[model samples]
Target: MRRLLLASCIALASLSGCASMGGASSSDIAAVLASPSRSADDRQRDARDKPAEVLALAKFKRGDTVADILAGGGYYSEILSGIVGPDGKVLLVNNPGYDAFGKKGYTERLANNRLPNVTHVVGPSDALGIGEGVLDGAVIVMSYHDLYWVDDKMGWPKVDAGRFLDQVVRALKPGGVLLVVDHSAKQGTGSAAAQDLHRIDEQFAIADFRRHGLQWEAAIPVLRNADDDRSKNVFDPAIRGKTDRFVHLYRKP
Candidate 1:
């Protein structure tokens, strides 16, 4: 309970910082929501995938180079490409396991679309293939916890989350923002349970990032809910696809 209050205070401070920056206009929101490269189904998927209101609140700017870490299926990759425009680049971080999961069909789709600004990377589990101090910002959406799944079968030679985060920190420019969103789990819940439940305890995540020199930025209830019991698996029919989630943003200090 004490920890929860502390987190609440930290979130309020971050919200104040965000409020100091000007918010996006409705027209800008429409432009992102209506991007032609995104299919109708893709746009609909964005609602649950990226969530426009949340992205807008993130204040991602045009001409800002960005990285979409763990870019599964390239859903957020497409939206980010549109947001960054032609001058800015978007690197899609694709691990070998992800490539195997998506197969050659994923490669063909990108080739057919011809997104010149988008680049696909296949690199070590610890490091993204981007140069240092080049990125403006990076986002890991519902995929950060997968770092825990790195094993021989996953083609990840190592399973060290610390090493993985070190690589992420190295890839970013000084003061670069790293926004993470994942399913919220209960307190004291460890990684083993997180894997079974497909959710992570928010406090554990914050502490892990802090250990890596990341400053707590914001915690938004934009997708939060108190109803989830965290007892069921994420794929369970009841709360599988519709679990209450949290969006936490962090920045390199």
Candidate 2:
């Protein structure tokens, strides 16, 4: 199955010149959604993730240079690769703090460097070092709140949120998009929930994004779970994957 995906990608590369013309098409989403090469594990998660819809909401397109911030184990990286086709590229980035958990699996996914157009970028949270105006879009999947996460024992750095936002802004080209999805924290709660509950207030997130000059484009409520109490830690077994989440899209001017 892996070979089939690889071969398909290789074949696509040969026809890539014409693939970028229309940006991402509905067919692109359909192909990725139906690909036989996708693993059962990924397929199982699909019911909960609704990736194709998420990608579509972000208006992700062919030939885009997109980044998956704190891309843990390349789940979205792999899907974006298939969606963007051979003409596009996906940059999977991990900061030092998050790398401990993600590095090994990410390396394994890229073993033999099979996904040619996908590149792994590692750096500190404060300084991403992405080339200015190089990226067309970026996504933070349930990870935007990590800007406030700190774990000394595990070597997680105390992230400076403002500096991190500055770096993200610098990485994007004008009109580039930024998509953020995260677990919802209680209303009126600030960064406290981010550290304790592994979540954030959606409004707080929007304020931060606006502060960094990203205009809020839209919000998707597909993942909302009204029953979620939003008080417990997100890792609690019962609400782990079912935690109500917010999907927000922003754009650079």
**Residue by residue across 141-176, what tens digits does model 1's lDDT show?**
877777665356556554578987877877778878
Ten-residue stretch with the least lDDT total in model 2: 10-19
Candidate 2, pairs of clashing residues: 24-62
lDDT of 2 at 92: 88
What's model 2's TM-score?
0.91
Q: What is the lDDT of residue 67 in candidate 1?
A: 85
Error of 1 at 167 (Å): 1.0
**Tens digits of per-residue lDDT for model 2, 1-253:** 6778666665444334333654444455646656555567778887898776677777676688899988988888987776566668999898876676887767777888667889989888887767788888999998888888887876876888999888998899999999899999998997779888999998899999999999999987888999999988999998989999999999999
**What lDDT would candidate 2 get against the real structure?**
0.81
Model 1 / residue 118 / CA error / Å: 0.5
Off by more than 4 A, model 1: 1-27, 150-158
lDDT, candidates in the order shown? 0.68, 0.81
